[model samples]
Target: MKIPFSLPVIDDEVIAEMMDTLTRTGWLTTGPKVRALEKEIQIFIGSSNPVLCVNSWTSGAMLMLRWFGVGPGDEVIIPAYTYSATALCAMNMGASVVMVDVKDDFTMDPEKLATAVTEKTKVIIPVDIGGYPCDYDAIRQVLARPEIRKKFRAEHVRQQQLGRILLLADAAHSLGAFYKGRAIGTVADITVYSLHSVKNITTGEGGAIALNLPSPFDNDKELVFLRALGLNGQNKSAFEKNQPGAWRYDIIDQGLKVNMPDLCASVGLAQMRRYRDRFLPERKRIFQFYLNAFSRYEWAILPPCRNDDATESSYHLFLLRLRGFDETERDRAIQQISSCEVGVNVHYIPMAMLTLFRNRGYQISDYPMTYSLFANEISLPIYNNLTEKQLQIVVDTVVDAYYSIAGTEKTNVV
Candidate 1:
């Protein structure tokens, strides 16, 4: 049987909650369920601010970029070791993406980001690639330089007449991850978390954005105003409209309809409730099992449990970086695993290596670290539903595949 990559660990709890939600007064777009989910996320993450539940993290990126006034002449720096959605959102907003290299650890390196900024740069949407949060405080230091500060301020004022350059975070893979003893949602000016099936927490197909915009950026009714912007600029939510005469509303801005519906939020709410009970513990246990099994292997370079003293991640995506391997060999290893009925996938190709950036004169050779990280990495299957037998299947398949691809005998296999 082919062991799939990550899949949602849905259970009867989710079914029961969803059933209960269905019996609630409303099933419309942004209703009680979404509010409950958002509240749960805020509490779980310890976020002081209420999170904005969006349809997807990609749309959250768009909403933040648009709110920050990113346009054709603007640029947003991003690490190349992430999914295309991190970059596509910038392009979708008519802003160019400046792809930077990643560190050996696969997270965005602050030093590399320092070199990527330019006069036209309006935002830096660094991704917490593979559920590993980047050094956000260090990145903030680079952006805080008087020269950078001046340029950022001037560019923002010139673009939207605002005074601050946005530090939007693509934290899609890090819903429950942490940095510096705090959650990922509170690290940057705006942090987006995905609730996709493959993420640590699943809402089936949903995401949330936590806003922490700087001063003169938002206060008073700004967050409330922004809430409306997230829901098609409509002044009143569906639940609010149920009240007499509250149906009369105004569209403050030309916003997109990217609100999270209660159906998806119901799943998220259940996932949140069972997170501490089932998902979190099982995920850690599974990771520990794999770590123990693979530690004896000569060619294995396991991913960081904690990037360093400053962070403690949710252990969502375990990036297995095989030693003594190149990109071609890595692909060969993946193929071998598939043949053995154990599916494997590469985290990314690096943004600069892709056609979209390559055609724009962004060279893969420029980001050597990003390329090197990509060349050796493989993502193993991880989910709560996987059993001990299934894990053994994965372990055996991977070892056998590694031996076959690296041209070593079964006796030499780890």
Candidate 2:
């Protein structure tokens, strides 16, 4: 029963695709494979807009921040409950990060976001924690308010085109998720999806940014610039420059080198091709299995996976919470679960608790909801290939661990 927290479902087909990519001459770096992946992603997310691939979510996010002209004196509001990359993207650009609290479901609370807006506010990054979509409608309403819009200062051309604060969704976990029947990519000004090893979809290590900016902002034109921006601001990629007598190129601006390679894209493309038909369904099944097993317990606070009429999670993680458990008790329970040969994890330690953000003047006490969610949350094993027998083992291990620390035993182990 030695089950791991998460595993990428790489089949023989995925391997064969990578092998085919490796065997191709002069196609290992960013080329046709990467372009095909970008198109595949556009189809999956039901978007006709441009989707830009980058080496990592952090880099893609930071690149977008630079495009918006965020820097000193500009402030980016983000939920304190998200991964460090969310805040780091803004911090790296020399912009002030204003941390706001999250809702009970771990998404950003729009009410607090309304209060966090200021004349310096240039971006609002609402993280969709645990694969669930944020309350985007409420957040959009907040940004659209007359008072909030009046305070917005557009310092750059792109910023002026948008004419208001940007809604950049940190949707690293919610790629396949939906908000009120609308996909994540279409709901935000821009949405970045992570393709890390542990993500629902993997490219070994990469990410894609879906561009859905409003009118007067041409996504196709923006795509060409961002593609070059990712390739160190070069006018042409190595793939394009490799042509006979076409080696000459030009550099426009100082940009980051974070373009996704063809080798990684091969893996992602293979998985994405069968994602709707195979991968996503298996993950959803695993999520439902956990919900049915844990819902019977009085102390188990199950994470939300679906809301029939509203949102649906991508089933990236099954975050289970223990009622009346503090951080110390939760840690002890995790140790017990580990001893049972079952792998478990905590989603995150709030950004406010980390030294980097703390030194920047953010306090844990200021974000009470973020602290509350982080203190008792435990992420369980969930992957595409987990069997029913292994699923039961995980359920049993977690429940036993809870009672072990509580000094109580249940007669029924089901």
Candidate 3:
């Protein structure tokens, strides 16, 4: 019984949408479908802010940073525990990357964040690790301090308009999540969601940005800049210019080629239509099953799934930690489970431990909590379509392998 770590749920409805897009849409590039998907996303996330679709979350983050005019000498603070994209996007813009530690839940530690801020701090990206929402209210409180806001220096019009430090939620793992009765998209100044195949909801390979910033900073203007940047500063898309007598356009700004195509948007539209009614609920059930089964074992250290009435995870990844297990033992257990045809994986290797970040002068030792979380973390399968039998097999195999490696027997099985 081979069970892969993650699989995107696809069905006849999704296929029909894709086929209709390919055959019916004359404009396959950023066309009506892309616009439709953006609208659908706005509705799904319940955000009045403009939702802009892009080729990837990395692109979306980079666009936001560029729009805010984050550049050389500016500092972009990020958690050391997140994916490389979070920090790398800042580096790409030539801003200094200020790494911070995380809390036990793997979200950015707000206290550490306060100390990391400086006059040069332009943005703080708090990652929602494993589909869990970071403490945005706590982070906001840190930024709202008179001392913190007083130290801020604005280098661009966008920065000046914001007045205080910007909170960008790296919500790649938390699209369907909620924070304090508000959707994750609405909680941050800017939230970027990944629609990659491995994510809870996928658009084959795409992402979207939900802008929740204040007035005077035009999201439309910023999106136009991004579109132009993607097309070598051209002001009009191919579809827009195709209209009779509308070919005349002007160069807006230097942009990057990162617009979402109609093909990807078609798939995303289908996924979003069924997301609330089907995908989210199924993922939650699978998450609960794993939590219930693991609770019986004294060795199991569960990931944070909920925070009273304050937050709810998207159940994107089941980050299970083993007590009394180090990196070597965790790796051994994973290997043993794989041998039993059950595929398990890790959420991430902390940026500080990665070669690129190490070369950039980051040390894993600098982030003790990040390192601790990485060492014992084993991400179990949590997808929409995984059956009860497969779920049982996954739990049983993990238990058998853990006990086998530890040379112990399971006293309690649930």
Candidate 4:
């Protein structure tokens, strides 16, 4: 059947929008469409916070950390089970990365996070693994502790004014997700969403940052930082500088080239227009189908989808786990499935096990739960445009491969 793992859903409408922007708009870099996309995202997520579009989530995250004044001697706590970018952004800024193990559901363990915090901790990035939002309430409770708050040391003006740690949601896998009846974008102080090709919604290669922090921290200031930092610390963007007699501008500080072009924003706008009505529902249905099929199997340990009103996933990835399969058996099963022309993959290997992290004095032995989850996890195909026949083939192929690798009798998966 040749079912692929993940594919971006694009239609004629999206293409027409992109073409219109290319042909009509003389302004391309961070122009009107980019501004429109930011507004549309803010409306879609139901947040009044200002949204800033950037080249990638990595850029957005680094900017957030920089704004918070996270530098040398400061510590940033992150879940060890996430993609390396969650921790790397902090590390790149010269901040110490404190790795915490995740719970069985693959989200950060708030309890472990509480213990990991120290006086040097400036930021805590909780990743939404596979479109599932982490327990924001639990994390808030940890931060609310008088003991934890007393240990916080302010390194910058923003840090001193805030008087506590910043909660940044690494929402690469979750855009339309919900946590405790509120949108994922609004749950944390600052939330970063990735618009990569394989994500739930894409803007070719871009990301956005949603600032949900309270007063004294203005969104306009953050936008200024994004503009200055994205354009070599220039205060004016190309569009703004194009205005009559407005060519003169000032460079505040050294920054990077990380601004999103209007071309990418056009595509993102098209996707956002139909996201809630078309994209989200289909992804949820596909996830439900996988859950229904896999639930009957004794070995299937379905990934977290919904847990009462406290949380809900955006159905980005179907992270399936085997009950007793070790790393070798899981790898063999993946090989078997691939041989059948069915594409399957893993979420991630724990950062502690990676060579770069290992060389930095991290060891897998320190994160038993992270390694336990990584050893047997496999991500199945889940996308908006996947057909019913393809879904059946994916399920059947996985079941067949698992039995073949386990030397058990083949059973009907449909």
Which predicted model would earn the best TM-score? 2
Best by lDDT: 2
lDDT digits (tens) for residues 53-154 of candidate 4: 998999889988887888999999999999999988998999999999899889899999999999999999999999999989999999999999999988
Worst 10 residues of 2 by lDDT: 405-414
Q: Report backbone clashes per prediction.
A: 0, 0, 5, 0
Root-mean-square deviation of every model: 2.2, 1.3, 1.4, 1.5
Please give the TM-score that candidate 1 achieves against the real structure.
Answer: 0.93
Residue range 1-414, candidate 3, lDDT tens digits: 899988886888889888888888766888788889999889998876678898999988988888788889999999999899999889999999999999999999999999999999999999999999999999999999998999999889878888988899999999999998889999998999999999988988989999887777776666666667766578888889988999999887766678889988888898889899998999999999999999999899999978778699999999999888999999999999999888899978998888888998999999999999999899999987899999999999989988988888777544
> Candidate 1 on 220-317: residue-level lDDT in tens?
35568767888788888877887888878888888877888888888888889778667877887888888898888878888876745668667787
The candidate, 1 or 4, that scores higher on lDDT is 4
lDDT of each: 0.80, 0.91, 0.89, 0.90
lDDT of 1: 0.80
Against the true structure, candidate 2 has what lDDT? 0.91
Predicted structure 3, TM vs. truth:
0.97
> Candidate 3, overall lDDT?
0.89
Please identify which of the two predictions, 2 or 4, would achieve the higher lDDT against the true structure. Answer: 2
Error of 2 at 352 (Å): 1.0
Question: How high a TM-score does candidate 2 get?
Answer: 0.98
